[model samples]
Target chain A: MTTTPTPSRPPVPGPPQDTSPTFVGMPTFHRAARAALDDTQQRRNLHHATRTIRDKRSRAVAELPHWEELRRAGAAAKDEALDHLADYLIRLEERLTAGGATVHWARDAAEANRIVLDIVRAKEAEEVVKVKSMVTQEIELNEALEAAGVNAWETDLAELIVQLGHDRPSHILVPAIHRNRREIRDIFQREMAAVGRPAPKDLTDEPSRLAEAARLHLREKFLRARVGVSGANFAIADTGSLVVVESEGNGRMCLTLPETLISVVGIEKVLPSWDDLGALLQLLPRSSTGERMNPYTTIWSGVHEGDGPQEVHVVLLDNGRTHVLGDRLGRQALRCIRCSACLNVCPVYERTGGHAYGSVYPGPIGAVLNPQLRGTESDIDRSLPWASSLCGACYDACPVGIDIPELLVELRSRVAGDRGRTAESVAMAATTWLFSDPRRLTAAQRATGVAGRLVGDRTIRSVPGLGAWTNARDLPNPPPESFRTWWARERGGGTREGSGR
Target chain B: MLEPRDDVVPSEPRTSGQRVALFATCFNDTLWPETPKATVHLLERLGVSVDFPADQTCCGQMLTNSGYGSSALPLVRRFVDVFGGYDAVVAPSGSCVGSVRVQHRRIAEESDDDSLADRVAELGPRVYELSEFLVDVLGVEDVGASFPHRVTYHPTCHSLRMLRVDDRPLRLLRAVRGIDLVELPEAQECCGFGGTFALKNADISISMGSDKARHVVGTGAEVLVAGDNSCLAHIGGILGRWRTGIRPMHLAEILAATEGTPA
Candidate 1:
């Protein structure tokens, strides 16, 4: 192997420590994946949850005769929106402002949290009730709120389970997918009292009972909350409307009950018009949670007089999104509707769970999205691209038809570029050189055959740099003679035989 | 019963005078020679002339997938050069064909080689996986082959999803006179031999392979069949280590078998 000499350069210090307390000290994907593999309960929980969701999604998608057409339309709409994102955002801002909603633009997560906090403090509210929003989690908004002396109460049942347990969410649609009924019951029994009304003293390991306990507890917070925070599924530019689809009614309660509503939406969530909502609404529910339609799809065009929250504020969050959108090859990640269907069907996510991804957005979409959204400066973000096996399941499941594997390859090339010359690069270079000429490849194959003779006809168990391949399986014994050599000897030197008889 | 989808091309026997070149892929060329031999035998039996192009090398799937697209460019150019003149190029592996058809254009575009991209676009459609060539190109389902033993077919992910060569393999297997083809439970899931993925992420790869092996063994079939040798090698390796009585065979081998010479 010809090693490319490393260019002489001054040694640089490592990437700065992630000072954000919520995701601080998170391990890289390789380490966290190893740890997660040993957790059999988490594995079981993930396997069960993903399998159930995948089967349901397949069934749900099968019911639509025009599903493929709908998927194409959804993908086309997102592409059009992404092509004109700046225009749509401006129009959406104008429409929302005209409809009696105040809009705030944030360049990053810190600015977004600061805007939301200012709004809360101005109202003199000590607490805020929240609808489960991935953008909020992505920005670690709850941690910021808590640090600023405001308690944020999660109203989504699964989100409540995760909050009460002080555990990170492991799935997109089902935040508590890592927990079973028994684990959820235990979390509720141990941690509910500190937050609000205690769980029922007779709380059992039944799912319905656990849900009821959560419902009763969140009801108290809902009635008294003066401020509500949310994330939107889609923001319509034509009407300045925001839509949130949820199985539970928490989003409705959060949108309607509070005196003031603050929505923190990613800038990429805007659609060109209300006409785009039909395909997406059909795609999202079937792809996520595998329902014909979600129970509550609340659409609000700013504030309705005395009907919903009288005061509404939409925080248009950039938060590294513009950087992602700037990438011509990678901007399709912006087309994600956050359905979590990609996660449900990804084998890597099934095995390692979401925490291994080290980002709020996990699974196949995260593998591409997180690396670009948060530059690959950190180890976790760098490792995220390699998290997938490049299976096309995510692309198949994605309602918007994001070519996730292609994006993954693109991101991998970027990550590979930063490393300059390394062992993998040298090896790949050598392999490429060998294959460039058939003669060189023949010689290499002959050498490999000679090496195979040293080990005989038995399966070898291990090799350097291939511990991963041999850890659970054995490598095949190489054939004594390569087909090229055999063909040369037996088939008159690789020339075509006679034509069809 | 799991019936074949209507989209699957019907196996109507036709004598095609088309000349074909075999891009036997580096894997079958180096390690799994039986796959290429079987493919040659099967194609020849169906009355289509087959040529083994001597200068053909790897299709650069391994290089491209390992984040070495720049390194894979020459191989792509070389592939088009070697097989560009043929009426059709056939390979035993779906993944290599998938790389050639789907990823080669991107690699060319990445380097801004318009000629290379145009060449790939011209040659991409002519490359075919084994079952696709038989069921779609040659329009033959029962290649007058018979394997008396029961077998289960694992649809490799690339063939199932990337190439969308759905049910073609199953249809071919079903038409074999004496073969009792059983459905592999959750057969559409990947066997985790994602080329370098098996090496870079060994633990996950092994876990996935073991699950696949268990399902294959559960079917009580004496042999497990698949189109791609890469997947067969990974799952076959696990089965070998576990001492399972089942053996992994390429689809070409199963399709080439006849009552007179059982594979």
Candidate 2:
């Protein structure tokens, strides 16, 4: 592989520290989401992009008469892979070793980053170009490398914008989906010159010009960087193959041009056979980009003598995936392909954007997946489950049939179980006490009716300590007489319930 | 406003012997009695006798959905105990029936009583949202009701996604005499009244609800109807706040209307 000189910079720092756009200490989903709802420009951007993609995805999915079957098949394959995950992983390691790729096991993000940093150090490389990878973001690999004084340049167009703009990915498939084209143009004009090659001085907000600038800035780095890092869409055990699908060909360059290549893949990404990829390949493109097929799908197995990278290292990362797999109901989240179909259709995500989720994985999937992957100990993780309105839109749109609404409720229960008594919990307890028996409910309703008579049909605009709802929307006063009271007094003859059996 | 119809005359000649119970669903029972009252009027007009089980109160959906599955257990048993014997249990709310059909069994499975689980499963199919009961089980496209006004419908998320009750409400509304039924843009979207979700995540809820309100008002229809009253209350609250001169109505309320009935 061709190599060029590393750009001269300051000396390196010690080990990796957690500096990769940490979502830590974010406010609760309600508070954070409430704040995000005020950004009108960002909301408009999300509205346009999500609506366009959602419509296109629906049309693309509808073209195949057996689309539902394909979805089920995709789900079944992931389920099977997860069921026999240990076997597949062991088989994958053996096959990868035999095929000339070295396999490394990482129990968590720190171990995974250590392995990657060691490889870069062994190569004596100063910088490594990277393909767009969520696992890398999840593990904060770039921040780790940067802390160790190694430059990890992102090559994907959206990723490059996110990196340069110093912004976290808002959507999975479209990372910078929260920014409109004009905003992207501004980011490119203002930020590119500080980091690398300067943008065209008279650059207008044309799409082609922006892409050209990105291409121009990335091409030299691709040819020069001696090391590259990537994450795979699917890792097949039978053939010991890693597949990276992308719309841009930058992934191909990153995979091949670098002499030493390292790939970080989640253990849950393992599929038993290449045969399973057929249905998944169909489902992912249609669900994510609304494409019949991704423009570029690179399937690499270890190394060729002189054709591709001379050395290949694959990191099988557990990174709390096993913790997620242990829960019966929560385990279904492992079936996700990161296609982002749920994000496009979620009304809450459309309004608040993905930052409100406080994780790289945002929208409905993030709400369930983050809590499982990173336990519910953190404020953000605990709040993630309640971010959704239980609309079931995510479940219907999910290609894997994950039943996200079911999982959200399950996670909510898990969160509640972990907490001590609070005002909300006490209120819930009181409600349960009141609702358990019909007589109790009747008594409460009678009291509520007496209160209702005092208020009549007047609206309550705001209530202190209950302003979460009343501050936004007015509430109708309760009716003076409840349905059961009316029924008991008027339809007075028979207790048609068989008197509670 | 909703006085009980003491003059019990079955409008249609046909009558079924199926024992039916009305589950007004706690929210409707307390806040919007007009919905259940209309349901009673509509069902009785179609010659199907209705019964209100005095022991029936809440379906425990609010508890279960609010992450209090254990707290919701007593009501779960209470539901099966009171309505399990009936041939059909009808509710004016889609979300309540949806909870009965889906979430109750989930919570019951965790309760670890195989018998209760089995009974919950058996009862799930018998539970029907108002639109489903009126359209499918009753096998009536036309209830011979008149609603002489322009109306648009918002299919609540539970009815649209969970129950997959596609076009049933539309089919029912289309059959109403003198009714000018207009289509709503993004009608299938949620009104953001996710039970306690409004209280919990209120800003995002209001953001979503206002968009739904904008669409409802943009339709230029006098009434915005939906299967769930909670959603109606939320969207109606926004309409009322904006002084849009439009009001939200439940599907049962519109279906129960007739020439002699008050609008």
Candidate 3:
């Protein structure tokens, strides 16, 4: 017998809105993840790469006996900075000005972008070389600069690969992490020429070769660019110094060589004291790239009169951070040090790749961070919270004690309860009502157990309504008798053993 | 760097005035009765009394994790009402206990129910997942069971990370006589049986689950065991669909098996 077909999805609670520019008009996470899951090469690349990195991180972290103390200190430093964020910001600005640096405050992405664009326009530079920055990507500074006829060149190797390939970053640290070496070779061969210097004609998939090709291609842009833009990993409030950490020396080049330099920093990157930096330094490199220390750590307070960039500008960006700070449950996300350890460890991030998150920040941290940074009004932001299995692997890997699973669940509550009742929420409400009382649960179980008995012992290969589950996996037929029923009949339910076997 | 808290793990069963209750959990009650039954047998063998509170339905995990935090408040209250008197609450699930400990508190505080929040705090540590109950609280690594077969244990994500019951199940399995326990490759990775995640992100979940299945198959173990039946059901479904000829047994099921009793 045939039955009526029901629509697979109930109505979405809110209108679908994609807030991030790089992935504008992107679908919800599951839809995008479904597509990413189909890409066999990407899956293999992510699986191998993440496993290698995860193993390396474990070894690196094992070396530090006092790693927990440093981690706690780092988290405490961030919390302390965030607690008195206003005071720190004022002190930071004061120190920066005293050290002969200019500073700008941006309340939002538009303001941040505007501030950067105005700086580039003032310098009259056609192109500005950039240190790899999640904040810059968050504000879509390249797009903003490009729109105003100013080119923003990503100087970091991974960011450069993403820029040259015209692909959105998939991971926070390794932006083109979804692309294997072969794909990177292809990207360099095909896309690098149009941007700057052409890739070598005899380019292979060798790592060293790819580095050489990128270095050679960016050589001209580095020399030609007069202005540099960057984002700091840590902005020390005490000395007003901005620190940029990198494996490659490209961040250093962007920090010093340009005649005019500007740094776009998140207000949350503040470290309360110089003493706090070493503890965080120990945690970050070990957690981030599994290195004892990053190859290059650039700390510049201000202009040093012919030593570095003649002029320096620091833009302190809010950009919805205050909104996140207001949320007691979610404020811990601000403690993130931009370490991709969570991304590397996440199984969901491993399977789906970063594009599935549809934002600059992806992985477990992104799942919690994106919603708070960009409100849950958008479909992608709303769906981000559900992107995980609530696996605490991210939290386990987090060096800064950002309880990512807790944050994800908290954000999920905001997504569910803060909105108008959807079909899913109504269904959850029904289950909640049934489970609130044991009798209701027992009565329902009894009815289901009776139905299950009638269905017999056959495994359920497929269910018409739940094709998502049954299409791939087979569920066991429910046992004929519920545990409660079995206990009541044979073991005398509710009879206490009371210290007697 | 959460410090290794393995010291908190008890190595033998406690024999005293402590009262124990089994939270069969909604899923195990209706679908997998054998697991809870095996749990009872295993506990009885250790001279520990186990009580099943008839009023215990669920720990409100499904509702809370599904984003219905407020809706979970009633069920949270229901949980306290039922299990509040027991000295220790045990379940055959790590995820459920993680919820009762983690999400229940989040729900109470998020909804601003001060009394419920305090009750959840008091109740959190008393709740133990199976492996934790057996190795950490009961403090017994061996439950006097003999399973003569090749077995591989998949440490459920919640058990491995959330509950941090590292090596407890393995220690229990290691103590079992006539058992060849091979290490599962990439065992720390999730099996991808994330409730609605299996439904919503079906493709990714399948990808992750199938990979886990591949690792489990590579072990050449006759039985794939874990603490949570929910994860087993998902992994076992893939194993079943693929006709891998492997059985998915709960940890308690294998531990409860004695001479001439093959689980």
Candidate 4:
């Protein structure tokens, strides 16, 4: 079995795609997801990668008997923090400021970008090395930084592939899960510098060689960078500390090696205290990387004394998170620990892959979280809630117990409430009208049975208001006799003993 | 309206007096008629006198899940009217039962029927899935039912996730007489027959169903039992296609098992 080295994956050559970050006016999920789904290579790459992660996660999770309890605590803690978020933010700001770290609050993506760009410019740094940050990906921060004339180099291996390849992250943990070894080999051969070593002179798809190539390429940038930017795994409000957990130690280098450290974090990533932080630390690594402990767990509190970074700045980003928190049923989505367990176990995510989600977050959690955070007005966002088969695997896999399927249905209802012409809602209303009274249901069944014979083949090739439904499957033409009709016929077509209620 | 203290059973058990109405779901009323009978049998065996209100019809779960709150209102009203007086209402099908217990209030509140909403909220917790009633209300894990089949249980999504009745079915299954319950891998995952979702998105639905089918086959059991027939039908169809040795049955069918009778 080809255990393709994770970091050795070839770099995607171009800069990131120029499509705007907002999923506004994009095609429906059926269209967008299908476009991605049609690519057999992407599907295979995703299937193999997700399956590997899921297997490792199950084993890692199984090792802890109290995983469920730990998850519950983590979820509860996050919920509590969200409920009193303003207070925690005040506390965190006070603590961080006291510790000599300047905290900036950004209400949305534009503000956050402005803050980071201003900080990088003020530092007068020509370039900055970044640890892979999903929030930055969410806001398209690298592009923003580049547009502002500051070059940001991605330090995470998978992130480096995505940035260099000019591709969107396909999976949360392994952003480059959509590209295989041979594809990586091709990309590196095409993209890497010919003046310096020229990609190992026909580099085979061997994992080690690829990893060595990435290590060599990234090592130069890491040592040369004067400023570093990153996203935090968690922020402890009580200690005014930030944590970054990763399988690779590269994040540690980005956090500590640079003279100035700038971390962009979502406001919802806060925990009230260290005990709360401890609960999540146990829950996150196992659920995310399927590891007992992440290879590197870095925690930095403000400006350390002659250690790590002398100048530290933490930008707490809101960006619709406050709005998400205001929704009672929808608010639970903020509790996500970014374990990607939900994505790994999700069948829809398994098939369509993460890029189709049109956001940094994907899978069941993304289906609910993205639409709420971004507002479900756009076609892609509206289509997301319907992306799932409502299988609830993500809920099962979620260490925080997000109840994702319920939220998906809830969001779908909100979307339908917006459109006001879903046909599903109409059919359901008609069915309910019939079911409320048995007489009507039976009459309707008989009427449909008559219609069923008129169709003859008992298969409808087409129907109005439901084009997608007929794409691959057919309705059973109301079944020759309804179960009610069969019951009556079996009882000699006579009014059975309790037939007329 | 009524005395709040008199309506709900307190945390402490009051075994001397309790009442319940059996809203035999449409599927259980006609297609799987024995499910209601089994539910009644199990409840009576546990010293609870259950009333099968013949006027009860479908709970409009099909309508509500399909997003028809307006049409489902009358069904909710009828349900609240028919089974209103009983201390508790129980049903064999989790999805149907879950609809009544969970969605009924949502539908009523959306329709602006405040009184109906109040009634639904009161009746909600009282409406339990059969295993939930057996375990929580009747306070007995062992219902004294005998099923000798080598069976594996598929915990339907509505029953497990929506209702949060995780251990009820498993607890009862473990206590059954002469039953060998093989643990199903990924038992919490959905079987993919999400009401009309199976018909609407059959390709993706079948993909999910097939995955569930494979997991069922992996259990090496002779039978698969679940609370919802909608899910069972989907899994059964896939099993039929594969010509797998296992068949899908309902928990009620398993619990209704008699001596020397094959389940």
Model 2 has a DockQ score of 0.60
TM-score of chain A of 2: 0.93
- Per residue, candidate 3 scores C-alpha lDDT tens digits across A277-331 of 9889889998989888999999999889969899999999887787787666677
Q: What is the C-alpha local distance difference test score of candidate 3?
A: 0.85
Go through the candidates in order and give the clash count of each. 1, 0, 4, 5
Candidate 2, residue A417: the lDDT equals 86
Per-candidate fnat, comma-separated? 0.58, 0.75, 0.80, 0.20
Docking class of 2: medium
Per residue, candidate 1 scores C-alpha lDDT tens digits across B31-122 of 88889989988887777778898889899998888788889999999998989988899999999999999999898887778998899899
The DockQ figures for the candidates are: 0.50, 0.60, 0.52, 0.17
Comparing candidate 2 with candidate 3, which one achieves the higher DockQ? 2
Clashing pairs in 2: none
lDDT of each: 0.86, 0.87, 0.85, 0.75
- Candidate 4's residue-wise lDDT over B1-263, tens digit each? 11123222233444336667777777555445555666656555556666665456788766655544466678889999888887887888888877887778778887877999999898888888888877776676655567777889999988886788887888878877778899998787777677666654455566667778898899889999998876776687677657785777888777656454435
Q: Which portions of model 4 miss their true places by more than 4 Å?
A: A1-19, A22-24, A194-198, A202-206, A448-501, B1-21, B26-52, B66-74, B105-122, B130-153, B163-188, B199-202, B213-225, B237-263
What is model 2's C-alpha RMSD?
A: 7.1
Tell me each candidate's TM-score.
0.94, 0.94, 0.93, 0.81
The candidate that achieves the highest DockQ relative to the unseen native structure: 2
Arrange candidates by TM-score, descending. 2, 1, 3, 4
Report lDDT (Cα) of residue A357, candidate 1.
86
Q: After superposition, how far is residue A486 of candidate 4 from its true place, in Å?
A: 8.9
- Model 1: reference contacts kept, as a fraction: 0.58
Off by over 4 Å in 2: A1-21, A496-501, B1-15
